[model samples]
Target: MPVLNPDIARAFDEIADLLEIEDANPFRVRAYRTAARLVLGLSSDLKTMVEAGEDLTELPGIGEDLAKKIIEIVTTGHCSFLEKLEKQTPPALTELLKVPGLGPKRVKALWHELDVETVDQLTRAAREGRIRSVPGFGEKTEARILEALQAQIAAVPRFPIAVAAPYAAALVRYLQNVPGVRRVVVAGSFRRGRDTVGDLDILATVAADSPIMERFTAYEDVAEVFSQGTTRATVILRNKLQVDLRAVDESAYGAALHYFTGSKSHNIAIRRMGQDMGLKVNEYGLFRGKERIAGDTEESVYAAVGLPYIEPELRENRGEIQAARAGHLPKLVAMGDLRGDLHAHSKASDGHHSMRDMAAAARAAGLEYLAITEHSRHLTIAHGLDPVRLRRQMDEIDALNTELDGITLLKGIEVDILEDGSLDLPDSILSDLELVVAAVHYRFDLPRGKQTARILKAMDSPHFTILAHPSGRLIGSREPMDVDMPRIIRHARERGCFLEINAQPERLDLVDIHARTAKEEGVLLAVNSDAHSIHDFDNLRFGLQQAQRGWLEMKDVLNTRTLKELRPLLAATMSR
Candidate 1:
């Protein structure tokens, strides 16, 4: 089996987690965590590079020691260091670290003091009122742990789109290279642009003698082949992602794609329409009383039912069919529609790249403008800038704007929204920047009313332009804050401020439903990369996916406007 980048990254992360739990050297633990992030963020395939004899140590944050481990995992699919660490610390203890309020120190306390090794053990202790007696855990913390444990138990495992992308793209590319294979498309939530996917449903059309199923089952990343047939196969990747592949002939390709690219409710609704038209629609083909009609093209499939082609992102059965019938479906915003990204960071903060490098990358990505929104001073862990440092960065941006050719850098700060709903920086400093992206980096467990009111109060400030990662969610890791989203959207509408659909895969906040709500409330949304490094710009595609699912039109996205148009809109948010 081939070790993918994510597979290696997971191993490194697990090692870091176990090390931290063991109270090992802080720097050593950080090195492993950083190495894991570096691996995960690379745009290229680490395993392929290792196979090709590339110097793995040349990669940032990867030392000679880590490089050897990378080669070990790539060559043998296991790391001895991680294996040893798992033996020293219970591997299940890592799950306890995922509980919201449980940090490494607290997890250590639970392990040594309470003998809690897993979430179940921790939950049992918490329920028995034993957790509160631990060193740092109070009654409130125990209750929160119990609640988090229950929520985790009830939630289905879903992979973030970014985590699934490498596997999907690799599989598609691999299948496309197979002799006689005509088309390979990943359907299901992935194609529909959902933030998280349960699994990949891959559809392909190939010649009868293609042996596609056999090829798929033999792929380097396949950990196990659940089943295999001439036309269909199910396999799990090494990273634990299940992929189901189905092959059809060209005649049924479109119908098969439509059937597989489904929101189940949407498919049921469309099939009902087919029944009304005296026809039947399925993976085979569309038929009218035993006579094959349309199935060669998705457009033809829609036309057979007297409807226009609906974009897959809009096929959520959320008034999409009705909108299509009325010809009111939005012209969804595409990747090229974005003119700039408004949230990013640089070396002055916790970002890995320099400002100029980030700007050059944005330009390379075809963006006309980019904002450097470094964290404000309150976020000291990021070495966030004070007013003095911020002013200096602003000057740097101004100078670079003059020297740069195509891309212009905007001066901005991701100011923290304090516990009392106040801005982190003074208006005197904030007013000097091109944009003020307010975020809630702390106090995530605030009650819904308080959190909503806190955000609204921050928006009341004259300088607040956008709400960064409006929900503060980290996919499977963190739950979305309990704020009332509709109220926040309405407030943004009234305040003339914008909400962010953060592109970071882990925090695809202002998710599809909230983005749609903002659009319906006549509020524009900004789909920003929130990039900390050049590679992070790629995250914008995920943000675009979320926006597309929200039925966002080009006009509904704030950053899609030219710099001239965007300037006045952002300025308008500050006038009040």
Candidate 2:
């Protein structure tokens, strides 16, 4: 029911795309991103003012065009430039830009050199030994590029809770073993239950020893140590994510935990408050009452200043403090309440395994069941299957169902929602699918009104079950599809359709606030991982975190049923 300020995430996406699109000044684009980070930290809605016709650009860091876009979204629910920009960009090329470390500069170079517009072509070029021969590329770089490409292709776009949970547990496991370690806990976005993890933070109390920090970094799993010190250490795990470990003394453990387990800005505001009270705050004890009255303990630390424990997602240095001060902090969802995964893929589309492989993974995670929604014919690069292939996959599911044990599989399709919001597949074809995860894969650069209408039209589909990845977000790469999400969520609820909380790291599409809004509207959510491989099914952890961060619960979700029960939910639409 609240309007979100998408500026920071928006700016990061656009600036990266501007780089890949090879449009605009690199410096100016960089300004948008720098501004985005700062703005994302601010909790107020730029839209409310924009809707009042105020020039939001007067706010430091926002430019005129950016202000205009804010106005457009607030007023009409879309951005013109983002829409135009997307229209000009080939969706295939946009997906290509998502390869980590491969910016628009490199993408443009590849496009210019090999005339390869898609990942598949680029992969072929990299593998057959053609890409490295080009200027600005060589053997080692080529190998790394190919490896990244292989990862992008071979891996699922998302993973589930079952896969990431163990790693989170293992990462937590390692920190607990540190000598002198006391009360170490996982923090950052993960603790808040996000849909994906970029890094892990562990807060603990040690004797504050150099030897302990050294031992912590010297652990066998430590692939590379970025920094090491008496009370702090940063290292990379086998996964490329960064992990920051902080240590404090026993007396100050809780204070240190609150400080180090911070979303940074959350800590900063507390320090500022401490400063206002003539106290100094750090990973050490809260230096108030001069005798350092506040000893270690997050509650004691917050209680020292009179506040409740803040959720990490809400801790983005936003209005959380003011809200907490007023006893109005937003309630966030927790992972234990999530039921099942909705959007997943198998070898059926561009996935690594069969439907049975995916369902088994879900069951193992104690999930009720899963919806195997493979890509439709529109996504040629993903090898979206045709009608015949679709039928064959259904038969496969039926065969597996007869022999099934616990979790069941629902037959679904990630159908393409065209620029006009029409189903890319015919009604007859759509009629057979148990669930439809429709998405916009093309013409993303349309005007605000059109983009909103485009999506709304798709939701109007009598056969449509869920809107997949409502925002079409690709973290660090692409901007959201220019559509009015709150409006669409409201519309979907009215239409008896559900929205997807895509668990993919790049496209946690139904982000926290949006998911919360859907819940308020009483719309059911399909928390899907969009997994293309067995590993991706594990992204459900990230998805659950995200959904919880938005304050979603098990009852708000639809796919938490056993596969047999879920099938009827979808098939009932046909009967209607």
Native-vs-model 2 lDDT? Answer: 0.70
Which runs of model 1 end up more than 4 angstroms from their true locations?
25-31, 51-68, 123-133, 138-144
Q: What is the C-alpha local distance difference test score of each model?
A: 0.90, 0.70
Cα lDDT tens digits, model 2, 359-455, are 8877776776677788889888678977888888888878888887876677778889887789877787778777778988877668878999999
Per-candidate TM-score against the hidden true structure: 0.95, 0.64
Query: lDDT score, residue 370, model 2?
Result: 73
lDDT of 1 by residue, 1-576 (tens): 756788888899999999998889988998898788767767889888987999987666678999999999988989999999988889999988888788889988898999999888988998899999987889998898899889889877889888898889999999999988999999999999888899999999999899789999999888899999999999988777999999998998889889899989998998899999999999888999999899988888889998999999999999999999999989999999999999999879978788999999999999999999999999997889999999999999998888999999998999999999999999999988889999999999899999999999999999999999999988877789999899999999898899999988788888899899999999999999998778788888889999999999999999999999999998887777
The residue-level lDDT of candidate 1 at 498 comes to: 95
Could you tell me the TM-score of candidate 2? 0.64
**Model 2 alpha-carbon miss at residue 194, Å:** 5.8
Compared with the true structure, model 1 gives a TM-score of: 0.95
